[model samples]
Target chain A: MNDSQQNIKKNVLEKIRHGDVVMRPKIYFTLQVIVVAVVAVCAFIASVLVVSFAFFSLHESGELLLLGFGVRGLLTFIALFPWVTLLIAVGLVVLLEWLIRYFKFSYRQPILKVFFVAVCVVCVGGLLITFTPLHTNLSDTADRGDLPFIGQLYEDVHMPHEDKGEFRGVVVSVATSTITITHNDHDADADDGTRVVTVPTNFNTSILHIGDRVYVAGDMTNGTVTAYGLSKF
Target chain B: MSDSHPPYPTDEELVTRVQHGDQEIFGELMDRYTEKLSRYGRQFLARPEHIEDLVQDVFIKAYQNIQSVDTSRKFSSWIYRIAHNAFVNALRAQQTAPISYFDFDTFTAHPVYEDGHAERKEAEEMRVLVEKGIKKLDQKYREVVMLYYFENMDYQQIADILHVPIGTVGIRLSRAKALLKKELPVDTTHI
Candidate 1:
């Protein structure tokens, strides 16, 4: 060995002998693996729950019906979409993918491949979760005002987006020029849920029943909605 | 490399000993990797100063992290991974260029078709010409060429060391080779 190489060996050996540098214990690595695994599982579950909740929100609010109302309805749906929740889910998926990349089989593939698989897993898992009574039970708990801080998320699910010209409720009565519906504005069962909506002459009021749920799109004047588009839900 | 009839304990065997508290056996690892890391540092840093210390730091870090090594895998790959990080850190400290957090090339999949013997021969033929033009290539591309040609690491080993997809190793080497062809066209006729 050359002078510098020999000196490096000597110095490193001396440091080791003097206990200046010590190998980390096996438990340290074991704990790291456990921590990583727990965090990854938590991230995955959080991602799935958030995605399912988003779907539940769109379905319960009748905002999803806006997609059929035309371009303006589509725009309003886009504007009212729960993007913040989805963004959080996306961030979690990315974090999960990063953690998964530590594995040999996963790291051998490209990041995009692994990420695409992760997104699919989350979406499918989320869809499956929605099929369960999870969100339904949670929503029911929220309606009873028995839920905690997360109850507020479900409160808006049944509320109308009147500013965006969207209203959803059960039909209470039908008239030649107007229809009266009972909507859950603040309370689902309050008497104030009743509202008057004026429809165009060409609108087929004959298709409406007294107890049918409906979605109406129009401008709100005072407390009444002037209907431009209507669909039965 | 031929484990069928070996004259000495393999790097993995040495690692097992070190993990069992034989720290002196780590010197064997340092001996095996020192010249290799020195050559790597010289080519990677493209600078003479502090190369010895940088290599020494790699050994020190490896020694400290030895317990984390999986004895089932190639110890050479593990140590080379450390060397790669140390050299990259040194390169970064020089403020040579901005290293991006995300690289599009590694994010996507590419086809990897490796003919080990043919590629090794080709790399050997192109080594002299490539060394002359490697500095002109981008940092990402330069490192791949150095590992594949000079260090004699295969695509999988290089991928393990760099923590990129194996296909990414192929992509970078292909791109690096193309850049070399453009830079040293006269000397690369045989390659």
Candidate 2:
């Protein structure tokens, strides 16, 4: 080889030999393995919890025992847990291997394959745990009357009339696209003292009817009330 | 001179040592493969800046995942596989960005010889020209030429490293040689 060519080869070799490419330490690898194992355990626990919750909910409602089958359902689920976990674990490992091979990750960065496999195992374990027949408690529904703005909106819009010392109620009804609500209140005053208001319906205001609770803003004239805006509560 | 140790250890021995966490053995593997790997990277990627990075990545991966690799399989092939994967990934990443150029003048200016002589100047000029010529070739042709000429890889080994058919490697090498011949100075008596 020519002197320059030889020099180039030598230079290239020296550079290759001395070049620093930082890599994750062995401790990091060990930690990664530990974390993966922990994640798998946690995932398995989660799966078991899910199964148990489903089972407990069913059992407490007496649904499992009602059809003359007591403890058999629970016993069968318990018996199958191990097989299910094992299947899940095996599936996880297979999926991990397939992914690693398919992506050629091991060829690129080998440790990445190990990390991904561990993650897959954990995910599978979690799935196995969640598939168990365990119960999850449902929260109680809130009372609708306790909601804000409903009672005030109800009182302002509804009017009533009195006849011979007996009060007759004027009910106001409000309808939207999905719901309709009605409110009724009694007033001692009769026809001459009472006023009815008709508000124009725009984008914001709608017509009020019997058994409807509405909030109105405007003036009450001689036996005629003019409303500026009407809102249904 | 030939009495004691072989010039190169057997592939199996090297693999065993590497598996046992012999960092020097891993470095030996790097020394053994770097040229071929660099040429492969340069040819496939068409980028000089990424060549060393790709080579280093290949070696590191080989070291870390040596267990999964079958011991009976050719170590060179396994190393090449790692290099090839790294190069392909780097190439894909490059596609999304603009190409960058290195200062070749600065690279070639470093004197190869300490003696101040007219012959050294001529050789330096030729070296510069040759480097430029190699850089000018199409990425694929340049890689095959570099591997064949600079790294001294046979057609089959080049084919294995490149994951190409042996015939394809032969054809490419012939084409690359023809192209280099045209690019180089046509002196009847000189190399």
Candidate 3:
């Protein structure tokens, strides 16, 4: 190396060594590791808590019950606790790393590597947990109801009450909570004119509106058999 | 290799020792990396006044956070990573709250030349021109080039430091060199 290059290297080495001594303070590394670990734990706990709270809130609002009483059914399918915790821990670590990057914090080199590996291990643990039969079963139950053909029947049944006599009509006024069906036959009496029925609050009542031709099937009790299902003719 | 200084411990060994509470070893690490890191910091930030302060900040952070570092990985990369982060943060701070009194021209003035020979002057001018060319390049290209040439890091090492793919490092280096060659009167092709 040239004299200048050699000088530069020497200067760098000397400065680094000198500065290393001056800058290196005792207990800093331990403190840093503790800080990182604490931050990771806090973030994971916060995220899981927030998610659980939102889920329970939705359930209490009757949304989940209306959507289908699958919450209890799916609970049996959850992955083992150890696997879930491991996955959450891994997710939290990754999140912590991203946060560290965002804030531009530096940890000791050895500690950083260990933190990274711990995160990866947690991620693998989570993936393994998610793939377990219990987890898969829970997911399937949530997406599709547990009872073999009951879900389809629940989805297909839309008429007010199924026991009423056959009545062909087109939907007229539809309100926030009710559907008014008007029969096509002009000779139909005013008392038998437009059939107003109460629809379940949970039903996707958004799809039904005025002017939809529908075939209704139910018994005619007091001139109104509650229609069980309505088919678009 | 024949220097009077004791041989520097490998980063892993230093980390293991540090984890065991051997605080002295950390000082050795600081001594090992500070100068090269300062130069790297200098390349990202133009203000020579802030370079030492910036480098000092990086070392302090490294020393303080030493326990968190994974012992298995190369200590050098981790230290460089810290330095790079420090440099970027300093640059960001400068952008958000700029120092109005700072003058680039004042910082660029050459240290007084003791030898006034024509050959020495020309060589000095060449070195200045090279530095000027580097300063003119975009930050992305400038960073890779500085780490590769001034820091004496290979493409893979530069990639790791910059958090880019090896191919990206190669591309940036080639572009930076081409840009520098165009800007400098000196024949960088031969260099």
**Would candidate 1 be rated incorrect, acceptable, medium or high by CAPRI criteria?**
medium
| Candidate number achieving the greatest TM-score relative to the actual structure | 1
Residue range A86-169, candidate 1, lDDT tens digits: 999999999998887777878888898998999999999998988999998988888888889998888878777777887888
Name the regions of candidate 2 deviating beyond 4 angstroms.
A1-233, B1-8, B20-24, B34-47, B68-73, B95-132, B188-190
Interface RMSD for all numbered candidates: 1.0, 14.8, 13.7
Model 3 chain A weakest 10-residue run by lDDT: A155-164
Residue-level lDDT tens digits of model 2 in B72-178: 75677667767767876787677876434321221221222223254335544444444557776765666566655555556556656655444556566556656
Q: Tell me the tens digit of each residue's lDDT in model 3 across B57-121.
A: 67666765666677776677778988888887787776756534322312221222223254233
Please write out the lDDT profile of model 2 over residues A204-228, one tens digit for every residue. 3334455554433334455333444
List the candidate 1 regions with Cα displacement exceeding 4 Å. A185-192, A200-202, B1-6, B46-48
On the 0 to 100 scale, the lDDT of residue B188 in model 3 is 49
Candidate 3 lDDT over A167-227, as tens digits, reads 4457887777657787533222232356765543364657876787655443455645354
DockQ of each: 0.78, 0.03, 0.05
Per-model TM values vs. the true structure: 0.94, 0.35, 0.43
Report the Cα lDDT for candidate 3: 0.54
> What is the lDDT for B107 in model 2?
20
Interface RMSD of 1: 1.0
After TM-score superposition, the amount by which residue A31's alpha carbon in candidate 3 deviates from its true location, in angstroms, is: 12
- TM-score, chain A only, candidate 3, equals 0.33
